[model samples]
Target: MNKQQKIIIISIVALTALLAWVVLKPVQPSDTATTTTPHEAASEHAHDHSYDHSYDHAQAGDTHDDEDVVTLSDAQAASAGIVLDMVKPAHIFTMLTLPGEIRFNQDRTAHIVPRVDGIVEAVTVDLGQQVKKGQVLAVLASTGVSELRSDALAAQKRLSMAKTIYAREKELWEDKISAEQDYLQAQQDLQEAEIAAQNTTQKLHALGAGTSAKGGLNRYELRAPFDGMIVERHLSLGESVQANANVMTLADLSSVWAEIVVSAKDLGTVKVGSSVTVKASAFESQSSGVVSYVGSLLGEQTRTATARVTLPNPDLAWRPGLFVNVEIVAGEANVPMAVTTEALQTVEDREVVFVQTAEGFRAMPVKTGRSDGKMVEIVEGLQAGAAYVTKGSFTLKSELGKSAAEHTH
Candidate 1:
């Protein structure tokens, strides 16, 4: 029984192995059929992916081409009417500008003061009135005037009595009816009387009263010391004024002081005897003067120094305290190259300008010099009257910056 079962199991196992081989074995194609191996198919897929990735990369690069490119042609520039210019020469004046005010010259100003304490009985001159030297400006009344008059009158009476006594004594001595001592005394008395009369007359003169035969009463009169306009008056009619009180302030406006405030750093340029041009707002004309004084002390708040120039004011048009713009011409250049201030451009740390050339507007580097308000002196790399782009310089500068950025890429 065991031999027969073993024979059957061997046959079944053999059949199972044959079937397994047939099911598991790969199928074979005919010679006419084309096919790819696993490795070959994988290689083909990898090649396709590489090609697609390269194509996409190329498309992305082309998409951004319009943004990074610029096409500036000579024809387009010429169509825009860009032109070139030649350099020229001109004079350049260097100036120090300052603000100033008009003031009365101290040398030509006067203060009218009363000589005696009195009530101001009359004020003949008013503010802004023109007066001549020795002109009576006011009349004052005081007890001092009455005392002076009484003393003069008393001296006159005493002199007359002494003269009468002396004449009588001299007549007696001449007739030999009196001693020689008496006649001597009479001569001394007459001399004394004449001396007293002269002393009284001199006192009256000192009090500003005339020594006339009529001998009028003395009255205090305030007079102008010089020929000038009365700019201020402190006394009114019937106002009590003290001795040595200022009654009026007078100013001779033939000349005035132009006081200017200059920065301390510019003190070197502003010196005495320098020429100055003062422009006032009230008048359309400009006044020229010489610098008379430069203050040594600096202002604490403004850090500026005061300078004064004396200018003639014959027309009295320049009033005191009027604001003015002052320009002090420090020096001049005979043939200097300069340009308008608007033509200058700044790029980062570099100061630049557009120069008109054969090609077009080309950016230029320049060194600059002193500048007035309207024009600037060119120290290097620019010529006078060379038509650099003054108005549209910023537009050109922006385009140049864009172009520079493009070249970096």
Candidate 2:
């Protein structure tokens, strides 16, 4: 063959080989395409088969088939872990709570004031000192007593002279040696002197000066008027105190007043003679008493009425000015159907309680009456001897909500 022909034949052979490679060679998958490989697909398929078998085994262990499924629309008719006592005839006490303060009884409180103006000579009672009735709390000096002593001395001198003259005149009259007018005049003078002296003595006694031997009027003695503890002292030794000035405040803590500020709305519910329970944070003590007084007028600022509870303070644990909580028993209903407070729940604005039934717990709309802390009186919608769920009703309620949402969907 010629050289050119041989070259053309070789070129055509090479071109045909290239065309065959382009047509028959495998094309690589694009980056955007699914990356699943044959080996991976096989592995996933095997895993899925094993997972189905394990799920079947788990379902077999449960024993509950699809036929055992039970659905409840109401929470009260659903099964719950907690059970409640059947409502029955019982007494329910209604309580009204109010914030209060510990106070000294007005009748038991005394303000120690000097009857006469004087400098405080000595303070016998300190603040918070227990004192007895007629106890000398403090001593003072006053010019008022000195004037009284001077008046008494003058009266005594006049009385002595009058007595001497009267005795002489009486002896003369008995012997018929004096005129009747002269004897009568002498008797009148002696009577006048005695009256003057008695008046002076009375004045001293009223000034609380009868105890002092020295006619020296030290108006300094300030005594407690009643058996009580000195809650406040406004005077110190050598401090000049004015007449009618408050020296100390005393209170008989054996009995105290629990003063509560009640809202005007609660005024009708609170009345005199209502039972009251008082609690204070100052001491771990609780006291029971009765409402002794209720203010007819409302407070100018708060528009609340004041109610006083008389509580016995034998231990003196309750002090004045201590904040306290007061609970008053407003009323009571006898033989009322009642249930635990926890059994009652609020559904919207209406009150409800869970009533247990064969199906589950069914929410029973109930009318609630007075609540006595632990239990609430059922006014309507529940019968005596009906079992109910007290606790765990919340869980049932949540389940009911889920069911409701599903229905809505």
Candidate 3:
């Protein structure tokens, strides 16, 4: 072989043997493992062990002084609707709130009726129309009224004739120009006519037909008995109504009754002449009234007694059927320091108020006295002139809870 050919063969064999040796070598566990140098390994160990020693120390002392404190800026407080008010001396009332409804005052209300049977001829007043006392309400044509008026007229004629006859008889008796028996008979006749005339005239007057009918004898004018509003009407033109029929209803709304239900237990709380404050549920209105009536017997179904408070309804503001709350001032107290009821919160079994501080607010524990559902008397743990949250105190309570949880974690 040539020298060049010999060298080529030797090189090819060396390369093939080297590849075979590598394929035959065994794989050790160290080869399968991920490679990391001593520096890289130290870096990893340090990373896994790294932690905030200061945070660990802080967590050990979890009960921080500001733990119950909620920090917020002025803008944040305003946005969250956090309202603050000063604690001050105030009066607290112990009240009993009972549901009630406004009703028409029965004493001032009347059911108007045509006194005699009649056919309606003219209706001057209508439903909801205001009327004055003695104003004509309606006109009716009644044959009954006409008969009474006719009897009255006939009685008047007879009375005139009897007067003349009696005068002549009296003169004759005095002059001794007539027999005594004849004069006595004329006097008896005159006396009987006078009695009949008086009776018929009164009967006509009782029917509200008056002493005389100018144009129509059957015409009857029904007049209002008081100044009021017509609440109901049943008679119309050409309608026939009976004497006792409830043809109309008039109500004097100058006064109204606030009727309340009192349970058996509360009967002792309410009494006649006790003053109460009434608040309307349908509108923002408040009024004061005195208890006027209390039913003696309880209702069969409800087992409650009905009580009434009289309220003067000037301007017709206290309308009938409006739901109301009658707040009876059962007791009152004057406290040196008080806060609104909403300012109090139950936190960790403690009654607390979020008192304003230079660093936001802190939940201040309080000892409370009398509470009237509106304001509570802070007997201890808070001083007057200190500002505290009045509204939106719940938000401060939540923030305090969160702070506690974070410290625990």
* Winner by TM-score: 3
107-169: candidate 2 lDDT, tens digit per residue: 989887777888877888778789998888887788887787778888999999999999999
lDDT of 1: 0.78
lDDT for position 177 in model 1? 94
TM-score of 3: 0.69
Task: Give candidate 3's total backbone clashes.
Answer: 0
Clash count of each predicted structure: 0, 10, 0
C-alpha-based local distance difference test score of model 2 = 0.80
lDDT (0 to 1) per candidate: 0.78, 0.80, 0.90
User: Candidate 2: where are CA atoms >4 Å away?
Assistant: 1-89, 215-219, 281-283, 334-370, 374-409
Task: Write model 1 residue lDDT over 308-362, tens digit each, in one string.
Answer: 9999998888999999988987777744676667677786566777776655576
lDDT by residue (tens digit), candidate 3, 290-399: 99999999999999999999999888999899999998878898999999999999999999999998877989999999877689999898989999999989998998
Work out the TM-score per prediction: 0.54, 0.62, 0.69
Pairs in clash, predicted candidate 1 = none
In model 3, which runs have C-alpha deviations exceeding 4 angstroms?
Answer: 1-86, 339-375, 379-381, 387-409
Best model number under lDDT: 3
